[model samples]
Target: MVRSLKNPKNAKRKSKGSKKEDGSSSSNSVPSMPAKVWQPGVDALEEGEELQCDPSAYNSLHAFHIGWPCLSFDVVRDSLGLVRTEFPHTIYCVTGTQANNAPNSIGIFKISNISGKRRELVPTKTSNADTDMESDSSDSDEDELDNEGPKAPVFQVRKVFHEGCVNRIRAMTQKPHICATWGDTGHVQIWDFASHLNALAEAESNISKDASTVSNQTPLVKFTGHKDEGYAIDWSALVPGRLVSGDCKNCIHLWEPSSDSTWNVDSKPFVGHTGSVEDLQWSPTEPYVFASCSVDKTIAIWDTRLGKSPAASIKAHSTDVNVISWNRLASCMLASGSDDGTFSIRDLRLLKEGDSVVAHFEYHKHPITSIEWSPHEASTLAVSSSDNQLTIWDLSLERDEEEEAEFKAKTQEEVHAPTDLPPQLLFVHQGQKDLKELHWHTQIPGMLISTAGDGFNILMPSNIETNLPPANATA
Candidate 1:
């Protein structure tokens, strides 16, 4: 569930003279300070200026860099309890990198004690060490002066060599120890990282970060079935070990879990989209149902039990539909982000060809790199973009004309938006360059982890209004 207003700070903009939406106001007028909210896709920086994050917007923010930028990564569900609301969070993440000249690798990281001095106000790694962006944690933090026993945060990496650069990486939800990767060499590989997981947990590893000679680099199964490199891949949530992969050639393959710890990938491919499939999401509730978005500007719903054709399809956007997130909590709700930086929410029950759009917003100026629904909230979703911003939105919100008038009078903002910026837009996170993908931790209520050109960020937004008390709140 979302709060009445996304940013609690925004409520301060209202004057005591102005009536609340429910017609309540203070008996005595108390003027407030100017309300300053950055409008992305609309605001531009002047000369000698740069964007800075309002640190109060975050609960706990920590950033770490892998030597090379990872194009994709997945948070491994930890046994640290499924509903973590406490601080000093620990998480395991698996990622594959796309390096320049260096050999690519898959790193399983144990990032722990991800807590720092809470900032009353802060921004990028540039503004202060205690800020929004990353790099406080590295592969080897030996030389940093922290004689006081892990003061900031620490990351332990067990990296195994990979053949080619990984285009995408995903850990199977049912079996987190087993993972799959899509490589630029038109190869799809499945790996069992039980030993790697053990080594990371034990703070010991034999696998060198760049050595391919180690037996651990070998994948349990590799299929060169796809004609070209692809980014669309997903493990089924309904069925353990079941997987689905879609490629640039518009061919999708199904992997049935075999008893021998191997996969039986069908030789025949599922064909539906005319362009490259950009992303895939299995139905959180139904094992056989899944969804795919493509460069063809459409989203397709497929059932593994049905034939190659999609069970249903929608012309989703004007440009390529870069990503689609199927809401796990609200099964009928689906959200999509496009290459054009516009994102929309849809109610799948209105799956007809004409219109199913429940909400739409064009706030980002570049292609949407990744989009995901909050596993904990049915109406909330997050989107990352090439515009270098990640935005959180709650579809349950609507623009309050009176609230805006008060805010506008205090801030002196213009009358119209770039066609009325959806009030549902809650928070905007910046400071990552060449941003690629982001994911919310299913085990942690409000925690999020994202990968970009700079590295990775693990932050919980203070303003997003989660069910848990503030991280600093005492028991």
Candidate 2:
């Protein structure tokens, strides 16, 4: 079930200094609105507190669930321009299922007409029944208003049969129609999504038709070299069709495009990690250079020109590093998330000097599920944790005593950040349950699509300061 997004709204700070009726000067203190701060793992809910996402916080928000729960998904890069800022947006995504007692199939979903504010489906019951009644009536009117826009968003899916449950899915950045899937049964398979993409594109023009078009069980290429199944896989953005897949058995295989639609999988797997490889990422600038994090509590940077071992290995975290994202805009910065609810940003340039972790955070209460740097903003990034919070962070923001003092004077002691809260924490979004992954839309500046056990949330917060000066911006 999708819960109402719970958010704390900061009251707008009004201009200081107003004249009193007596023409005498009075302390220009700003009034503070009620502060609803819910630190995901830190704060517990009151007796009957329900999350109500402030609708004004989002430019677009929508949620929908597929029949089966999916653990991994990817946003399909389309022919559409790299930048799109228009109403009623359309997005394409591919995901696979982990069903308990049904056939597993990979699906391509076309989500369209996503333009509307979130409306409360169920009114929260309060102690005062009259207030609750008024809230219920207000929600009814708002629902009608929500419908006044260009119709509610829709999902059109086309499926292709697969043998075993899919562990993770990654669409090629250059050729989105071709995607690779890791299977639970010790195998990696590549599938062409040309047919699926065509069908979804056609469905968009005529959304009235509703049917599941299931294709035959076939993959473009298949490999069963790994002894154990795993989840580490990545498609190189620097190289057109170069791919890498790492398994639980400390092995990584490289896939190079040999033809228009086929890839040459090297049988000699690259091996270094003594434990399971949890994640892999190709460098944004170097075609042969990539990074991998493993359960051994370390991250390894590998170069294909070198032999089987990592070019350089670092003791990256205290526990298993579950995820990592190499900054595309700022190629020197690398971000990593660990199983112990901690994430760190490292400056790759400092590796030769010594340990290179420049910034670290332990704000998440649970293991981080995903972390990604914003494609548009060099100093901004977003992280999702199993604690059900997708937090956006701006590394450029720092604690300034003067700014803090001014903020306190404006809020009039009504609202203040907890001492433990970091100044970089820009926004906290909570609504979904068991959130697994999130990615910033390459085309939209602040737009993001997140997948969770309940369903998915497509959100673009209105508060992402567009004018925040970027550093080393060349994305």
Candidate 3:
């Protein structure tokens, strides 16, 4: 069982905030002009109310309950037993109940509604529900006629690799296939889901004969140079064979894969961050150009064209820079978030000789953990902070008309034209705890996935709907 971290409310505070530069309060506060709250539906209830059925079983359960409903009961139940599988649309529960004279065998069931003739109850299906139903029915001929009828979903917990808690998870695609990266103390393994599914089938064929171990499993390619823990990793968008990784040693290393299926480390190391380099991103347009942010309160842009030193360095924040993202639409644009409770956007094309203060945001009060740009829209970006909030911004929309007109006039002669409207503050998603990562899907740009220290979540733009959620929804 994985233990939950102590809530931030229990943490000890260091000092009260000092006064601001303009004599205003330095402490963060909600606006005096209250904004309207959006209530999802009429079935909303306060924190501690118990519903008729398990909320986690249904993806649409949140459609009934708004905001953060109390999930202690759900967590307690999960702790007491085990969930066989948590899919995008359903949750499978496994229970071990006595059957014959021998030890009880495991049975699995889907925890969803079933309606037959007149009765309605939660439906239970086997793990192989699509294929093994006929075999299950033939094996239990005697019990089939016992009335009380078909049993309610019988939960049989399966042995899942990273079951209870997952600290971090990332996915990478190599041509027609995809692999997942999981953070663990053991050798970093990339599980090929397609191959693993086939292995499970082979294991099942030998189950009755008591020889079920599948020895054909492939191990993941591990990077072992980092003596300390590896904290962050980013795949090169331009070349999937190359990747960049950061470690707790305050060092960043570039890795390239060789034809012999081995990874080679580049001899030169990027070593300017006084503290650990927390984040790194490679520009999509400029493959050789990448950015790195660190606890040393600096953000540096490096061009592989330059042998060692960074091309440009900016004193980005008052504290550690935790996250950074490059705008896919705007080739010269980049954004970084920091522990100093601020995020800044810079234009690589414009930063020359004497120009300072590109564009900065001071909206977040706590450390910003992750920043992401919209894959479909260049001007849109989203950020997640330790304060448990995700804010979306449409950067193309300018707030000041006079300033926007002047900016347009100044850059109008260029080939590309700037939009007149100020970027829109799309929406704010709150109630998560200590969000650490945010990733927008490549195929569907509006959809995003985020993982926090508390739990994993998926966020879709309010206007969009998806038939099936992404596989890594609950990372």
TM-score of each: 0.80, 0.83, 0.56
Instruction: Kindly provide the TM-score of model 1 when superposed on the true structure, using C-alpha atoms.
Output: 0.80
Alpha-carbon RMSD, candidate 2: 8.9
Q: What's model 3's TM-score?
A: 0.56
Residue pairs of candidate 1 with colliding backbone atoms: none
Scored against the true structure, residue 14 in model 3 reaches a CA lDDT of: 16
lDDT of 1 by residue, 249-307 (tens): 98999999999888899999989899998899999888899999999999999987888
For TM-score, the strongest prediction is 2
Ranking by TM-score: 2, 1, 3
List lDDT for all candidates, in order: 0.75, 0.77, 0.48
Score candidate 2 by lDDT.
0.77
**How far off is residue 48 in model 3, in Å?**
14
C-alpha root-mean-square deviation, candidate 3: 16.9
Off by over 4 Å in 3: 1-35, 38-169, 176-193, 197-218, 354-357, 398-423, 463-475
Q: Give the backbone clash total of model 3.
A: 14
Model 3 misses residue 261 by how many Å? 2.8
- Model 2 alpha-carbon miss at residue 71, Å: 0.6
Better of 1 and 2 by TM-score: 2
lDDT tens per residue, model 2, 315-371: 999988888999999999999998888999999999998889999999997888899
